[model samples]
Target: MRAVIQRVSHASVTVDNEITGSIGAGLVVLIGIHEDDDEEDAAYIVGKTTNLRIFSDDDGKFDLSALDTSAELLVISQFTLYGDTRRGRRPSFSHAMPPEPASDLFNRTLRLFEQTGLKVQTGRFQTHMEVSIHNDGPVTILIDSADRHRTRRG
Candidate 1:
């Protein structure tokens, strides 16, 4: 599993001209799943995302976790995160998990978040989605279950 987490003042997902999910003063999470993903991956990601200390403190230091501050989450499935174009003009999605498995993991992942007591909103899976975001501090981070490297202070 992989995710691009963006701290946003507001974000929303629209499908077929209808708003599917929306949030305010929270994080917009773009999620990707691979073939090898499982419950452990979902649990790991859920723990990391909610506990990441990205928000500001009273002294303006980035020291508050989303959980501590009660930030909402807007999750959107994005298979494109695995796009690989190193070999051809067209990007290949060979590294991405097949839709059936990926969507299953995606749904499970979101459920884990909700189970953790965080308010979670979700985009329609496998649908054409348009996202609108007001990125706070333009703060963005890439998270991967395999990659130990973490972006931003979170």
Candidate 2:
């Protein structure tokens, strides 16, 4: 599993003109599940995301985590994150998992985040959707489940 995390002042996801998920002063995470990904990847992401210290601290350094700052999460499923364009002009999604597996893991991850005592919000998986993002600090981070625990100073 992989995720593109954006620190946002606000973010929202709409499906069929209905708002499925929305948040303020938090992270908008675009997630991708590969064919090889499993529950451990999902578990890893929940921890890394909730604990990520990308929020500002009192001194204005990258010193506060989502947990520390009480931030919300707007997680959107994005299979296109695995799109491969190495071969031709068109991107291929052969590297991503099938919808069934991907959706299963997607929902499972949301449940896991909730179990961790975080207020988790999510986009409609396998649906036609639109999203709006107001990025804060334009701070973005990419997390691969396998390397989720690596410290910045590492």
Model 2 lDDT per residue over 119-150, tens place:
78887898888999999999999988857556
- What lDDT does candidate 1 reach at residue 101? 85
RMSD per candidate (Å) reads: 3.0, 2.3
Error of 1 at 42 (Å): 1.1
The CA lDDT at 22 in model 1 is 90
Encode model 1's per-residue lDDT on 1-154: one tens digit a residue. 8889999999999999999899999999899887788888888888889889999999989899889999999999999998888996998989989989888889999999998777899999888899999999988988888864456565
For each candidate in the order shown, give its overall lDDT on alpha carbons: 0.89, 0.89
> Each candidate's TM vs. the true structure?
0.93, 0.93
RMSD of 2: 2.3
Cα deviation at 77, candidate 1, in Å, is 0.5
Clashing pairs in 1: none
The candidate scoring highest on TM-score is 1
Badly placed stretches (over 4 Å) of model 1 are: 148-154
Question: What lDDT, from 0 to 1, does candidate 2 have?
Answer: 0.89
